[model samples]
Target chain A: MATSTALSTTEAQRRRARRLTGEVLASWLFLLPAGLLLLAFVFYPLFYLLYVSLLHWNLIGRARFVGLANYSSLLQSVYFWQAVWNTVWMTAGTLVITLPLAFFTAQFVHLELNRRLSGLYRSAAFAPYVFPLVASGVVWNLMLQKQGIANWALSLLHLAGPHWLSQGVWPLVSIILVTTWQFFGYYTVIFLSGLQGVPPTLYEAAAIDGASAWTRLTRITLPMISPTLFFATVILVLQGFQTFTQAYVMTSGGPNGATTTLVYYLYQEAFQFFNIGRAGAVSVMLLILLVAITLVQFWLSRRWVNYDQL
Target chain B: MVNSIEPLRHVLSVPPHFLPLHPEVGPYAGAWNSAPFGLFYLNTLFMASAIVLGQLVTSTLAAYALTWLRIPGRQAVFFLILIGLMVPEQLTVVPVFLEMRTLGWINSYQGLIVPFLGSAFGIFLLRQSFLQIPLPLIEAAKVDGASRLQILTRVILPNSKSALITLAILNFIWHYNDFFWPLIITNTNHYRTLAVGLSMFFQSGSGLTPWNQLMAADVFIAVPLFLLFFLGQRYLVQGVMTSGIK
Candidate 1:
């Protein structure tokens, strides 16, 4: 009887082991499709991109491993530096214009009297964000034409609009304006949500303290919404770096490469010139730059982004 | 200043007789007849649908495993998947293009659809929702002899309607408006999506693109998303908020 019981226990243990193995197998099976795809496409491509960045190969020719030659040449290129500068300027310019505008619009829309009107304003504002980039670029192209509505509107103020898309510096400004217009509503919505989360009692208490509106805004609202502001700045900067369609369509990265941002330069390198190696180098630089920026932003957010509520 | 602007406003206003649209030659008709936008629309619909469906299935399965399965090294696997989120598509464009060329998928629907099928964001979103499901409920389902797949479809999914819808809508809008991948993958009008097609249409026929027709095409391309935003603005806002906070 003792031996039989021992045998049965061992049998049960074996059965349990089999079931456990089956469960693990099933779990892996579930993860396999996503895992394989991500490995093949997203993760593997990163390593492959690094490898390709070292090679001098057009699509047709056999890849000749050139080590860091591509990187060195790109670093030496005037166009590459110009593109980097343009990207930085665009990000800074757009952030400066967009953040304040979005904050104010969000504040206005968040007001009690404007509550009913908020939906209308939000939809109208966000309408531009949904338009395909190419389409918006096209519309902006038309709007920024010398004889277009924008210049006509400016002429109403007796300010002659400079050639918006055709001139050198004006194209950069035009690209920034178009990008800001495309993104302002998105940031506004983000800020509006943040604003809504700010407790009304704080504002009421400030009012009872006889605090001025400006003082209340500076002391209370800004601090309360600094987290959102930080979030918007990170996203806007990222979007600014990814500016391609506007420059591609509205300006074609020209009036002499004035509007050429990093991605545009990368595209020009890879597709236009078929210099895959140099484009890969640009891609690596852009990736490192963005990731570094994002990390630094996160680190810096500790100083200013208030997380007291949560 | 107000009095001076009134006359100018009248002059700037579109003339009452000047119609933006005519009876026979509407902007919609003009744009539609001018380009193969119909083909572009169809291709975009097919590609978007394929991407959304594939992402939904893959994300759901992966999230389910990560949440409920008693698998070893699950955290490591989750982190491995999350790494995809950090690597931007722009960074991978050249290598992916080469991969597509090697796989003979260039200008093919698979090229556009497959690489995007497994979204890290989708999986992350779904996992968050799945993790919120009460453990006791899942245990009860198991006691009733419900298989993992059965519990997933019957219990976990039905409870996650909002999350699933959010994923679906977000994926649809994103892929629908995506330009970069489609631009590189497809060389011809055959597989061109609306974004790429519109761009090519604008850039081609060198002298000048017809502004009115292009704007009309833009309106057409944007209408679906506009309708979606108006109808489901709450879900989109919720998704964005969740992403931001998380």
Candidate 2:
């Protein structure tokens, strides 16, 4: 009995050691390709961008070390500040317009509409979301043209339509409006799913207790969908910072840079003018801005987003 | 004729659908003046097909290896893929362009197809789906003396159809809509995709980009994607619901 027990114990130790080795080996094999790709493409490029940011490098010329000059120049450049302001304004405009439209649409679909109509409305709202960013830009630019359908409709109503493409603020407004139209459906769908997750019993109880629709929304629905709201906002903000396609297609940061966003500026510097070093600096700045915003989001999420409420 | 076709009549006479429709084809309701519509449609179909096929094959292989095989350093590999998710494709634009140029693949299908084949997001999403496949099924396969490839093909893949479809649809839509990579890589009109071709047409300084023509082009590019999504929307939503927060 003692010999058998000792033999079994030894076997158990061997099995444990073999399993550990297997796990370690398995993990390495699974991870190799993904790790190598990220390391080459992500980490390498990021550090290279940082390194280039400190230099006075154009595409053709040798990169010369110019520490802090690019950073200082960028900080001082009024164009940089204007682009930053434009990006912030555009992001804010999209959020303000999209959030309310999505909220009410979610409510309409979830609370009021029948399944069939809800499906129709849901698809209608979401139709714009699937359009390629460039395609949406093209379509909206057409719709917003000086003598386009929008103006034609306005003329029929005897109201003067603004020159959407050529004008200063109107182009910005047009871009924001188009972006919202394309994106609002995604958020609405997200919000509807959030609403579905909210237990119907709570809403029923609220209704019985003399809570108005507004009261129920503020007290319950809003809190319940806060997590979804958080996710949508992060995505929106990230896209906003990375706004390039629309600007590239529609305005090209036109009408004297009225809509020149930071990413557009980066594109101009990097690709158009071939100012590689400066572009790298700008990319680094953009990354920093994104990181800062993400930190703020994390902080706010902790305070308001209710993950455990469900 | 549309009125005689009841289902067609309701769709054609609607507010959104009140736009234009070309006979025997999809919506081309707007003016067809600026450029021929044929170019954009063919280009978009070609690009979307290439991207979807490449992404599906590459990502599935990567996911399969990661999930089923007792491969070495699996966790580390998975983490690397996750990191790829965060690296903006913008960063690699220059190098990729250079690589394409060196390979003489610039302005060709090869340029568009090769670099975008391995998507970290696709790998990650499919791996999540693969992980949920029960271990008992694989054990049962083992009892029958099934090889690894047989288990993957016969058992795991057959059960993971929803996940596969979801990935395909997402990939198709994303590739169909992507502009930047296409714009950077392809220069000539012959080589352009829908997004790139449309932008080039608009920006060609060709008589102020005739509004009706542009919107018509937009309709052309968007309608097929919209149809696909509308058809598969339930599955798309289900996929999102199933996939955990990244």
Candidate 3:
């Protein structure tokens, strides 16, 4: 009886081992396509980008190895510094206008407006976000012209409108305005969803405790939605660094390169001047900057972003 | 209600001469005559559809493996996908372009479509949805001697319809509106997507590019996406909310 039991136990162990191997094989079979594509397209290119950053090539001759030359030259270039400054300004400008307006609009939609009307408002606001950036840039380009509707509206207000897409500061501002218009609705919807997640009983309790509406909002609503707010900020910053199509379409990074954001500079370097090495360097720098910003945001979120209730 | 009706009343009171049919002449005609927008539309449609289909297949299968399959190093694979999320396309664009050039894929459909087939976002979203499926159901299927493929197709997929639709719609819109990749990959009119085609058209002209025709072209490029967003607002919004929170 003991020998028979020993044989059965060994057989069971073997079956279990085979089943485990089968599971691993099946899992790999499922993951193979995605894994291969991601590695080939995404991961492999990342390492290749780093390598290309160290080489001097223009898609023509031999890619001669140059250590730190691309990086040093990029750092020294006035145009690169200008691009960085423009990108920071554009990002800061958009975030300032977009976040506040979106929050207030979301609040109004969630709290003040009737339900049916709020749907209309949300759709109307989000309509602009659906338009392709190229299309939005074209429409806004026309509107921001010297004699366009924007100036016409300013004229009605008895104020002179600047040359929006023509001059230095105005071009950056025009890009910011178009960006804010394009994305305001998206952030508002995000905020709206965040707002809906806040428990109503908290407000009721605050009211019963004789808390003012302002105090209640500061104490309750803001804390509850901080996570979403943080997420939006991270998204905004990442996207801000990638501001290309608008500048590319509307300003063409022109008027003395006032609106030449980082990605635009990268594009110009690689495609326009065929400075492939410098472009790779710029890409690596941008990646570092983005990753650093994201890491910083993640670190900071612990202090400000409320996850207690969630 | 009164405020809304006031505008309608004012419009009704305007003279017949105020509102004219065919007010803008030759804008659409001029835009159509200038570019082969029909070709652009076909190219955009084909590319977007191909990407959506590929993403659906890859993401669903990968998500299934990550969620349900018993495998070693599952966390490591998930982490790899998360890495893909952090590395934006801009960071990889230069090398990707060079790689495409090396493969002679520049100005081709494969250049546009293949890189985007494996979407980390889609995998992440579907995995989250897949994780919500009760374990008992899967166990029951296993006990009934059902194969993993059958369980995934007949059980898991049938239950993940909303998530699958959401993924498809979002992917379609993203690829349809994508300008940067198509712009870099395709230089010729024959291969250009609508967004890239429109930009090229706008840039090709010198001064005094016709404003009305440009606007008409912009409308033509934007309308389909606008319609999709309106129709699928729920799924889009839900997708955003899901991603934002978790």
- Which numbered prediction scores highest in DockQ against the true structure? 1
Candidate 1 lDDT at A229 equals 92
Best by lDDT: 3
The digit string of per-residue lDDT tens for model 3 on B129-223 reads: 99999999999999999999999998999999999999888889878988889989998888899999888888888876666677778877878
Q: Could you give candidate 1's per-residue lDDT for residues B1-246 as a string of tens digits? A: 111112212212322223322233355676788779999999998999999999999999999999999889988988876777667777889999989999999999999999999989889999999999999999999999999899999999999999998888878888899998898899998899999988887887466556556767777898888898888777776777677421
lDDT of 2 by residue, B143-166 (tens): 998866688789888888888898
Candidate 1 docking: what grade?
Answer: medium
* Best candidate, TM-score: 3
- Model 1 accuracy (lDDT, Cα): 0.84
Interface RMSD of 2: 4.9
Off by over 4 Å in 2: A1-35, A155-158, B1-44, B65-80, B91-105, B240-246
Total clashing pairs in model 2: 15
Tell me which of candidates 2 and 3 scores higher on TM-score: 3
Q: What's the TM-score of candidate 1 when only chain A is evaluated?
A: 0.93
Each candidate: RMSD:
4.2, 5.1, 4.4
Worst 10 residues of 2 chain A by lDDT: A29-38
TM-score of chain B of each: 0.89, 0.83, 0.89
Per-prediction DockQ comes to: 0.49, 0.31, 0.46
